[model samples]
Target: MTDKASNSLLAKLGNQLHKNKLVKAGEILLLFIFTYTFIKLIMPLAGDNPLLIQAVVWTANILMLIYVWIGLKLRGESWKDFGLVFGSISLRSAVKVTLLSLLVFVLAIAGFIIGSVIMANITGIPEGANMSGYDYLKGNIWMLIITLAGVYIVSSFGEEVIYRGFLINRISQIGNDSKKATIIAVILSSIIFGLIHYAWGPMGIVQTGFMGLALGISYIKLKKRLWILVLAHAYMDTILMAQLYMASN
Candidate 1:
């Protein structure tokens, strides 16, 4: 291709990866790495302590707001669009949360069974079949609660805002195919969510993949109302925390 044509192609590709849900998910994965590295770098300056973890988590949450704001600006959506965030009747939201919570609970039980079976078959030890992530939660109940409230809530809602609300909606506009866009967004976001726990070992990947799909499907089915998935996630995490707390003592 000629120089101008090549440059045009590059620009189009950039825009595609920036705007498409599947493509943009890869970009978001890069953000995860960047944020991790930045946290590591800043830890030394701030002292390697619990306060450092809190600072990094809070900074990540703030980044979520910036991500959502940028997405809204790109779509020309005003504060009015945000008002839809609060449009659901209290009863409706309650029903949605209840249903979603049940779905997540069922899926989580199935996941644990599957994980146990796989681990037992592979390792030839039934006792060692438990999930490390669950073990971690059990051992660190208070920390898990803190992490869930501080990071999980922000990350889940931030993800819904950017992936489903903004990227999927924008792609639907470009292609005039809402279903395709939603599917693309959910799958890509789930994959990125799974990858983010690469540091968490194989079990982390498995656990997060299950979680990502559960939340993603919930978002797609609920028409991206956001609050429903947020409540479902929070409820799930809080219950896990509570269970861990009770079991530990």
Candidate 2:
């Protein structure tokens, strides 16, 4: 197919997102999942070049954001439709978001700790997330800086865009914007958010899933303040990276 024809087809599908939200939601979700899983599956082909792998991951993450951006544009909407206002951030709100981020950071930790306890009791297992994915940061300040950048784009910002801003909004649309729809959207989004950490292993999944629950609830309660959630996620990842860096000895 020619580029024009392909764009035409995608435009038609974008239109379906409005006319038939249920089906389109599934399609969007499958594409989202495929994007994540497929990239990870093909990652080994990139060999052991850390910079190359990081670049690929960063590109994939940015592309995911772009996909969301394009989808919104195709529907005659944009990030503004979802309350992501990056402009005009006053210091008062900045301070507020920072303080809230600390609180959310605490809640996230509590969630993981509680989840770890419950999971251990239920399964009699104690293995945690296979964080070896980040083991590359051990004693590597340069890589630490690089991974911190990834935390901002990939884990903190991009995940919020994909999971909260896009997924919650899309799923809620499937419910015709009812309160129940919002509740279900948060729950399902949290579940998917948790599952996405599958590389973390079973205990890791539970831990992250619980963390997702905390973040989802906060997102709703805070009136979908995306920046606050983004900062909160950044705070969590920052501390995690710091710990990893410190463990290098």
- The clash numbers for all candidates, in the given order, read 0, 0
Taking all chains together, the TM-score of candidate 2 against the true structure is: 0.88
> Over the stretch 1-249, how does candidate 1's per-residue lDDT look in tens digits?
899998777677666655676765454555556667776777567554544555665686567567556545444455335323554468876786678667765664465456556655766765531233344455665767676766564655555564445544444444455678667766666666666556455555556655676666765666565665555566665665567556655
> C-alpha displacement of 88 in model 1, angstroms?
6.6
Candidate 2, residues 25-131, lDDT tens digits: the string is 77567667868786788688778765566576677778788888877877878787776886887899889889987888788788889889989998998777777
Clashing residue pairs, backbone N/CA/C < 3 A, model 1: none
Candidate 2: 10-residue stretch with minimal lDDT: 49-58
Per-model lDDT:
0.58, 0.82
Taking every candidate in turn, the Cα RMSD to the unseen true structure, in Å, is 7.1, 2.7
Off by over 4 Å in 2: 1-14, 47-57
Task: Count residue pairs with overlapping backbones in model 1.
Answer: 0
